[model samples]
Target: MKRLNILVTGGAGYLGSMISTKLIEIGHNVTVIDILEFNKTSLSHLFVKKGFKFIKADVRNKKLLKNLVKKKDIIIPLAALVGAPLCDKHPKKTKEINFDTIRYILSIIKPSQKMIYPNTNSGYGIGKKNNFCDEKSPLNPISLYGKTKVDAEKIILKHKNSVVFRLATVFGYSFRMRTDLLVNFLVNKAVVDGEIKLFEPHFRRNYIHVLDVANAFIFAIKNFSRMKGNIYNVGLSTANLTKLELAKLIKKYVSGTKIRIIKNRKDPDKRDYFVSNKKIEKLGFRPSVSIEDGIKELNYIYSNFNFKKNKNNY
Candidate 1:
């Protein structure tokens, strides 16, 4: 793989921060642009690295983006109004960041520049039994967040040198601990309070480690010729597990953890579907971290860092 100038939008977020660090470690010059609306400390560790550059700005700024994009060889767009509840809280802002930001970047990204987009499996909306959704699956998004992902995907897929990653629910620890994410929240609760509250425990979904998701971006960027203009579901087939199943896995590591099943309940950010990850696997891309392993790792990270008890105090 050629040494390249990689630009990561939302680089301060969980997936982006880890991915940027990996790229820097591999001797790539990485520029991270983030709005810092949610948290600033996620990028704190990268501030002093010579190969890493942090730009505190929104992706919606067209002029700023146009000026910065000239030096970039590849762009990974991860900036968005991330979750359903957050999108619901700020609908217009979500649409602008999630959709319009793509429009702005697409206008500036050189025709020769390559790019990778991190989409969500939640965009699969719902799936039929015995029919795991692959890239060919119809997207029937159930939330504003999912809808925005679908919209951005349509705009990006038209590009000749772009790779779209419909990623599964990401687990594992980062500088940022988002309690809203399924696995992380469960692990945090189980480890800290010794119990996890459940809603729609039967809802099924796939999981992937944050490091693996970051590695997939690196893989896609390195193998861009073979991966270009393709949509790959980024995860492991074995990582697909239900909420109850996930809780049980956490219980194995965290002792004396109690589980409460809430009947007739639903999550505000509801999404349930088993995704097939055959395409990326065909490209020799396989996830190395398992959910059980992620739980153990996250428990260790939380024990040392304790992001939950010190939530937002950073």
Candidate 2:
């Protein structure tokens, strides 16, 4: 295997921190560029590794991005306004960071440099009952965050020697934890808040662990020749469940948790769909962590750390 210089734009983030650390452990030189909008301590563990580097900067800086893009063998663009509510609140910043920065990178990236993009399954919006959305499924994004990512996905698809992974809702513990995610959010509330109320309990969605998502990027890098220029849905086939089912699972871990369903309430996110992982799994990439296991892990983390005063860590 060839050792490469990889640049991760949001290396301090929930997903990026894990990917960067794993790449360094496997002997690749990983450089992370992040603005530290959340917790800055997430990637600090990577400092001991000689192959790791961190730069505190925004991805929207074109001059800085051009200079960095020229030096990297692979670029993983992970920085973005991640959730729908946050993106809606800051639409202007979302457009610049998510869409415009991608265009800048595409124009300046070298032909030999590989680009691995992280897209959301939210792009699928809603799926038909009992059906799975594959990479070929038509995207009908209903939120600002999903729309921006869909536009960015078009850029990656048009580029040669590039790959995109439309990941399902990610769970499990991370150095930079995000309670905003579906599984993590609900589980945290059940444990800390002592109960959780559901608006659309029957809404379905697929899930994958954080480390599994990191492994998908690594798998794509190792098999770039076979997977480049294609999009794959990265999700756990067995873990697709409705929101109500998810709450019940959490109730098992958090004792005395009450789950109440609110009738006729709509999910603001509006993304409720089951995703297929057959395409990526056929390429020898399989998710390792189960939702049950992730729940246990989060239960332990929350037990060890108090999230009440540190809500900004997300």
Candidate 3:
């Protein structure tokens, strides 16, 4: 094993914060550059750590990124307007941040520098009937968010020594909380509002814990040689569930959680598919968090923290 200098582009967001902390804890020198759109509290703990550095900047700032990308061994691009609704609200920013920023990095980064990119499972929009989607599955993304991620993955995959993880809906508690994600949103509603509303009850998708997502990146960083130039579906096989089914799970933890289904109501993110994570599993990485466990963690967060809950964060 070797110590490396790591750069995380969106190091203050949910998954970025988790992964950046993990890298620093494992003896890697980590530099995180974020615009702090949400705030800087998620990274407040890291500021005191020995091997961590934080920079407030945009990834699209070519003047800064040109010098920054050249200084690190690995680049983890986690800065993006994640989720369908947020991407919908800011389509131009989504394209620039999620897709074009990768294009810009590809141009400036040396071929020797390794990359790990988080592509979304939403790219498998309306997958093949009754079958689980794999790395070979055709990406027919319907939302601007999903489309941009798919495009970015293509560029990163073509880069030498780069890895891609087509991640599922990430859940679990984070310092920077997000209510727009399906599981997190439903659990928040169930706990605080006591009712969960579903527009499409039968719409199925995969989920992974925020920690597990960070673990996947750690696994790739440790095994970059074997994992490079390949795409893996990073999610729990047991956690492929629907909206109503997810509501019922939340009900178990938060009692008296009511569920309502609305007819003909369309989801902004329109993603419905199960993913097969066999490729990454074969490479010695498996997701350890289940949706049920994630629900328990959320229940604990809602019980302990005074979260300013809002339903329209996206």
Candidate 4:
């Protein structure tokens, strides 16, 4: 693999931190720009690495972003308000960061510079029976977060040297462990409290590990000419599962843990559906980590984690 200058925005977050780590490991010059919305503790692992540079900034800062984006090989835009509930709580900020930041970055970048934009399968909204969403599937986003992703995808697609990946719900441990994502949340509850809660237990969705998400970025970067101006759904085909089925997997990991179902507390997020990774698969991309392995890793971390002592760690 060639060592390229890789610029990752939101590189301090769950997936961003992991992706930055991977790039550095591969001998690339890695630059991470983040507002540290969750704080900078999660990114401490990168501080000591020689090839990695950290910028405590936001993408909306055009002066800073323009200067930083100069001569970069690939720019991955992953900073966002995240899920439906979070986006609903702060609609304006969500739109600004998720939609506006992307447009701003694209405006400043050179046409020769390649980019791998990360979108979400949640943009698929819903699905029909026996039907799975592929790259060509219609986008009908139901949440502010999903809508913002759609907006980003449109802007990136117009660029001749960009690839759009509509990602599935990411699981597994990153340098920063996030409990907000479904698989990690359930695994945490089951291991710590011996119980997990489910709402709309039968609603279906796809999943991928954080490590694989990072690999997809690398694969697209290396194969940029072939992948340019195309959209790929990046995830395992057989990894789609409902809330109930995922609970069972967690239970299998933490023996004797019970699952409790809660009804009517809130309606499900409209971003429910299965996705196909065929496009990226054709480009020789495959997920190496299984959900079972991810569950085991999360179980170990959560079991020994002390909230009081570690609250200030990350």
Question: Highest lDDT: which candidate?
Answer: 2
Q: Model 2 compared with the native: what TM-score?
A: 0.96
Query: Candidate 4 residues 1-314, lDDT tens each?
Result: 67889889999888899889888888899998998877458779778987789999877888898988996988888888887878888889899999998898888888998888888777574655554678778887777778888988998999899998888889987776678788887887888789998888877788999999999888887888898999999887878888889899889989999988898865445646777778788778889988889889889988887432322111
Off by over 4 Å in 4: 125-131, 265-267, 307-314
lDDT of 1 by residue, 1-314 (tens): 56799999888887888898889888899998997766668878777887788899888888888877888999888888888777888899899989998988887777899889998888564545554688999777888888999989999988898999988999888766576688888888887889998988977789999999989998987788999988999886897788999999899998889999988777654567777899899889989998889999978876667564434312
Full-model lDDT for every candidate: 0.84, 0.87, 0.86, 0.83
Model 1 residue runs over 4 Å out of place are 125-131, 309-314
Which 10 consecutive positions of candidate 3 have the poorest summed lDDT?
305-314
Question: Evaluated with TM-score, which candidate comes out highest?
Answer: 2
Query: What's the true lDDT of residue 206 in model 3?
Result: 88
Candidate 3, residue 2: CA error in Å? 1.9
True lDDT of residue 187, candidate 4: 88
| Per-residue lDDT of candidate 2, residues 1-314 (tens digit) | 78899999988999998898889989999988899888869988889999888889999888888888898999999999888888888999999999999998999987888999999878674645545688988777888888999999998888898999999999988888888788888888888888989988888899999999999999999999999989999988988899999999999988888998989888876767777789988989888999999998988888778866554422
Runs of candidate 3 with Cα error greater than 4 angstroms are 125-127, 309-313
List the candidates' TM-scores in order: 0.94, 0.96, 0.95, 0.93
Candidate rank order under TM-score: 2, 3, 1, 4
